[model samples]
Target: MLIKTFSYTSLFLSFLLVMTGCKDEDYALPVPKSELQNDAIKRTLGPNLVGLDIEFAYAMAILPEKGKIVSAQVEASIAGATGTYLEHRSYYTNGSGEDVGVEVAAPSTTTGATSSVTFNRDTSAATLRYFYRIPEEARGKTVSFTFSAKSSNGESVSYAMGPYTITNMDMKLDMVATDAAACYISIEDMAIYTAAEAAANPGKIDLVYLHRTPTGLTFNHALVSPAADPQYLPGVTLPAGVNRSTKVNKVWNLRDFHLARLQYGVYIDDVDFQELNLEGAPNFAINVRAEAGVWAETADGRYRAYIYVNKVNNGAKNATISMKRYTMP
Candidate 1:
């Protein structure tokens, strides 16, 4: 198989060289540092309620698949950020040309990043996000995102991207993660770290952990670069023909999941630590929590999945739970 290596200096040169063999595959000009992610607030058609003067709503283009929506949160390269970005999210609706302005708070202080932005909307579509405003000075800079999403089923999707720019943030790329299924994202609190804090904390940028459920059925929930790999890169590979340049955005691993729910809520219970004894992986515990279960799916379906939280630990601390998800098959 042929290969290509991209870099800031060689980006231009590589582009020109690759263009020679380019096959007119559709691709987005890369999201400036951060790509648009889905907000976690769900929309429901009220059985009997007021829908008038409904200026408190907005529709997200990311329509998640049927019976999805569990513990959905957005992630990106947000390390060493100056100020906090949106963590928890909500939405509002308005007629065309009407802007729904909102004020938000950061995530609650906890092991994992989050915001106390609990979005409870009673509308068709609600906009859940920590809408960013690239100040005049901050514009034209670089950024990226580390996102997380889940369906009622145990299946989950997480990704990382960018070093994108602030200028020219307009985007239109179909390599979008969410397909016919509408995506649910909880863009919660961000830890806008200081240079001192980031420097003091080495590997903070590279450190990653996975969220688990109350039941200890899932193992290796935290994502790793590779099995038995000293350095785990949480990206996937695809056929070259499918995308001009295939990007390993997210890797969804389905383990031994045999629960009885179609569309359930998500909660964290314990953080299953990984065994860092892999030659060079430093000895450390992953950060995670379990949660309460919600809307689950039937016993049979396509999107069904089992979890794989890190069981590579010394059996010292019990994993923590936070959010739980009811899945469908």
Candidate 2:
């Protein structure tokens, strides 16, 4: 993974442009005065065709101060398709919080993709759940989101959601149950395992860790190395799907049978950005990239692991990694 940096001067100029854009009446008065609440759209990601992770985040700067939001819902429809709606499989998590699986809502026609999906909480607890599978027709197409937030006093607001482009990246992986404790291995150990070793210890190994090489490999090292081997720091293999990168840029993707590493954090909890925070703070810096917060289940349906790439050193051909292990219930 590569990391990109910017100058403070440019950042300051960007801030000024944003402030200038907000001076208009249409931006200032879209919501009612009675509900003087403000929302900061953190980000909107996927119609992830692979993991089915279609997530959007926004913070209610004033909702808690004003009053509780009585009705909070998200509605998404295919662009230019009129009535065609997609379904949502719901999961909930707060901030960089726990991955609490599935949220069951009262059976309602409105909650389906075609209709507005109402949420239980209103104040910044709105993470898109992956309950509805993306139809084959909707893959690789653009889908729009509409967020409706209403206060108890009948002051309601509708936000014209983003026109996010869906990608065919694979997020689903074969997870397996393991009893091993948290551990770290050098890149040489990971890639150099012999064929006999892999077969001799079937299911013994599950997670492929990535980090900055203790010795460190440079960007040039990556360019010269062939397939994901010890000579060249390998990219994580993302879960199986059309979303997998067709062109191997030495950077890896998440695959069910394979995993990639990003130089994101030194410890498991310290990763720079969530696996979902791709667009916001992009993990890569200079020639290195760091991404953590990847969750997946085992192949036999026995175990799951929350894998994080603490950091990857391209110059030295090494990386550091961490993971949280869970036995599926």
Candidate 3:
């Protein structure tokens, strides 16, 4: 009977208050989703060069309870020399860093656009890998990637990774020279042996020397250890026209790997010779025969080289060695 006299608005307001009081409230609201910190994110570029299959891996942590990561994207911007820039095609990957199996549209190659792209993504963590063919325009230019991740709860996060620079040094092989008396021959110098210099003398043979000619590559594999005494011309020569396919099961003894017939008890296998290619260098295939990749470190280890043997001319007593030098960041 008393309810009959109550106003409809008043009754509705009282009912709303009662309903609100019936349910429990959460004092702590969910925090906003967070992107991985810069320090926590790991970025790696595998052999950066133009017109080559270069791999990029970004590993990050995704905090638990931040909602499952649903999707990830990358925006790449290439910087031009004149202070201008061009936008590359966006690449998408799963959380594991693998490429999704869809074709992505790429711009013209002359504009620093890569043709082939692949990557992988981790479903749990924020790990991603991108395998791309480096474009010619990207050489000597800096390219940056901005990554974004979205969550199931409609929350999105982003991280900026690198302004990784592509260099011509990798493609343009340099010729260098070091004294034959030097104890160690660094690949950092990007040295190639010339026909003019030969470490045949006693003092000259006591140290390590590298000679790279168009026909062959010569180095002292005998004195590899610091403590080991420099033996008589304990060097190995990789002759031109020797490739993995043609020179299989071949044994490289003193005659095959050395300039003269000097032996220091070191032997090399044909299988040990590995071949490498400069991403976009056409001359890579020219006159290069038996080649392999060798890494030589500096004394302080601040500098290093990823070297490739381009040619070996044993008759001419010279070898051609090409390299890409890197400094510790």
Candidate 4:
């Protein structure tokens, strides 16, 4: 009996030891070796449009004991526009949560598709920003970037970012549409035409703008298709071939920042145009107010557009408009 009790006690002790030893493994923080390392992050949001900047933050780090950062460079798949550049400063966040920039390099230089900066500071770590202005040639295409950094110790590191797609939409801003001759808008040409011009190119006229203070009615501002009813068109005479039936739908409170150029952060991307439904929509937007907009589609289904009314002058009978147009498949 004594021997059996001793055997049972030993078995229980072994079980306890096994349970104590079966804990999860300990996690170790990664420590960089004596070499340079690089990482890149895209900071710009929304659709990549033409004539706008695509921003990136590139960080390169090495132990001060190892070596100092010598230079950094970014190579784009396609050459950017004239305003493309790399910042010569390194940035860090302050206690107030604001970014503080410190000079770390001379002005960057660009040659062909690459922009580079040579570090003038003796620091071993830095985060630089690169702004690539989307060129006209990069529209409707994909662009990628390779970010590289070198150290005084002859070690180099590189990081790759995106093959981000550039949008195909066209944008025009601050077009004046008046109650007089310059009231005809052509989405294909992205221009406002006079009465004679509309008559000359009747097929290009998509929408007509007019302001009427008719008695006992509130038709302050309106946009009507050429083939709209006479009541919506007021006193205007349509050109001979300006009878295409356009589709229009009015919307409110959707303030697109790109079109409105206002404080709102809203953006209308390519997907909005692709997913817009104008089936059985009307051909006229009456009493349109400032900050309101409309979705319009051409009669032949070749183009889709969003027209934003930036401002309307009731006394002068004019409006400032902006548009974003997309071509249909």
Candidate 5:
């Protein structure tokens, strides 16, 4: 009986030891030294196209006791276009979810591939935005950025951003095409030409825009190739040398935001143009409505284009259009 009692006592002690070992313990994080720090993020989405802004937010911070920000700069791998700039203002979100900006530095200055902004206010932390307008030289190429910040206490920090690729497709927006005037479109030049202009560059004319109200038919806004059938080109005469047999196919409900600038979030990238198959497609698109579009290919098969109808003015017999063109190899 004494032996059994001793065994029970030993088991009770082992249970107590196990409970003590499972007790929670206090912990603390290691403190880091105060220093200048910077981070960057790309804010723009979709294909980085030429003539559009590639936006980034550069955030820099230092402990209040450390020092004030001296200056900030961004160096692009390839020089941006003339309009590229770094905003000197810092933005913060307000209660209404709107971004409110405050001036924390003087206006920025750009030289070559570098843009710099110097702080004028007493600020230890700020988030600045940089807008790099993709240049013609950067087309079909990759570009990167180095964002840096310097503090008054002789400390500096830099953050590197992506080598983003620029799309080869070209975009032109808000072009007006009036019936029988400025109606000829050239995908090579990406512009609308009048009858005289089309006559001068007849070979470049690919598509013709017209608004006709023919009897027994509903052809309000139409995009007809220069070589389309006579029935589709009612009351119209083709300019001399404008006889390319271009191909066109109509599409509905494709409101690409980049082209239509509408509420829809759809986008057309390079692959869309590459994968587009226009074999056996029609040469004319009739009764085109706002937000509607067409897929077109030049006669020589050198360029493929997407023409988007932004708006149509039936009373004025005109339409606002935009285009995205891709050059085929």
Candidate 6:
């Protein structure tokens, strides 16, 4: 995945610019405020069309604050259309002229040239989350964020977050379960941000692991590289609609299966961004998963591994792990 950065230009405030309220009066004595003229806006992205509403939660936007981010999002829906153009960027600059704002992901939607009936749009929240680690000169400084939008037809629109603060780095991690016997979780990648500096680094992949419980349930993490091939079901063919089998050697998507899994990821716990560099952090990017041995008439198992979103500094964000079993139907 690629990361995108957005820049800016300016204006608008006092609520009347973007809101209408249920207050007693239409002109409520100008809510005591201050003037904010420290931001700018620009046309960073041209146009796009993707169907769906996109959100950028603070805990998920990657950036200068431990849980804050310089991120961007694409929200749109299409009947048969493949996308909705949502761009036109604005930037927040500190006194030093450094970008201290959110980065939105490059919107990518697909449509068949021959048929309007065939469309491909993505609306997943591309949230980036992180914080600045060094003695950022922008700390404590008040900055501004401006965002505009481009229509699929070439029209435009914009909005500002009002005067915002560039706070100190505060990293955090939390999980929210999404189901019963099993729940969905939104993992926050609260790492400090460091300019990619170092020598000889190929950048590694972070894997999230979901171990199975004793009752034959567990989520499958990413696939172990074939180079580090551990024992996996070598020849079991998956049935139709099945992408992988819990057969020990596949990476599965939770939406595609109905099995249980316990999630686990390494980078979320082991990575120290201050130590990350061109060589990336010092650790084995490769790992071999442990296999499960069957017992009794029923077998209890799951793949052991980890999943992670690489520190991709761009306009939008991305951090997630697959929550399904890695087995065949």
lDDT of each: 0.28, 0.37, 0.39, 0.92, 0.94, 0.23
Off by over 4 Å in 3: 1-47, 60-64, 79-124, 170-329
Q: After superposition, how far is residue 198 of candidate 4 from its true place, in Å?
A: 2.7
lDDT, model 5, position 2: 100
Q: Tens digit of lDDT per residue, candidate 2, span 1-329?
A: 12234576678889999999888664454564444343425232322342343445432223455665444455668422232322233345668896554432333244445444444444422333322344555655667666565655556666665565554333323222111112111121222222244344434433333333334544321111112243333443322220111111222333221233223222222122123222232111223244433443333444434443445555444444443443433
Better model by TM-score: candidate 3 vs candidate 4: 4
lDDT per residue for candidate 1 within 1-329, as digits (tens), equals: 12354455488877888988877888779533122233232122111011111011222322343333434344433232223344334434578756464433234222223322323332222344433323334333555545455444345454454444443211111111121111111101112123333344423222123333334444333322112233222232211211111011121221212121224332111111111112232322233223211111111221111122323232332322121121221
Task: Give the residue spans of candidate 1 off by over 4 A.
Answer: 1-68, 78-82, 87-89, 101-126, 131-141, 158-161, 165-329
Say which candidate scores most in TM-score: 5
lDDT per residue, candidate 4, 1-329, as tens digits? 99999999999999999999999898999877767888989998778889989999999999999999999999999999998998999989999999999999999999989999999989799999999999989989999999999999999999999999999888999999999769999998889999889989998899999999989998889989999988898789887787877899999977888888778889898899999999999999999999999999999999999999999998899999999999987
Query: Which candidate gets the maximum lDDT versus the true structure?
Result: 5
**Per-residue lDDT of candidate 5, residues 1-329 (tens digit):** 99999999999999999999999888889875699999999998889999999999999999889999999999999999999999999998999999989999999999999999999999999999999999999999999999999999999999999899999999999999999899999999999999999999999999999999978899999999888898999988998888988899999999888997778878899999999999999888999999898999999999999999999999999999999999997
TM-score, candidate 6, is: 0.17
Off by more than 4 A, model 5: 1-33
lDDT of 4 at 217: 95
lDDT per residue for candidate 6 within 177-210, as digits (tens), equals 1111111121122222111210111122111122
Query: In model 5, which residue pairs have backbone atoms overlapping below 3 Å?
Result: none
Give lDDT: candidate 2, residue 43: 39
TM-score of each: 0.23, 0.34, 0.33, 0.84, 0.89, 0.17
In order, how many clashes per candidate? Answer: 115, 67, 34, 0, 0, 63
TM-score rank order: 5, 4, 2, 3, 1, 6
Query: Which tens-of-lDDT digit does each residue in 1-329 have in candidate 3?
Result: 55765777688899999999899866898874364422114233333556544444444344655545455554567522221221122335789997554322232222232222222222335445444455667866777766555655566566675667665433325232232332333333434333233232221111133333422443322213222322323343322321111101111222222212133333222112222222232111112233443443334434434444445544544444444555543
lDDT of 2: 0.37
lDDT for 275 in candidate 3 is 27
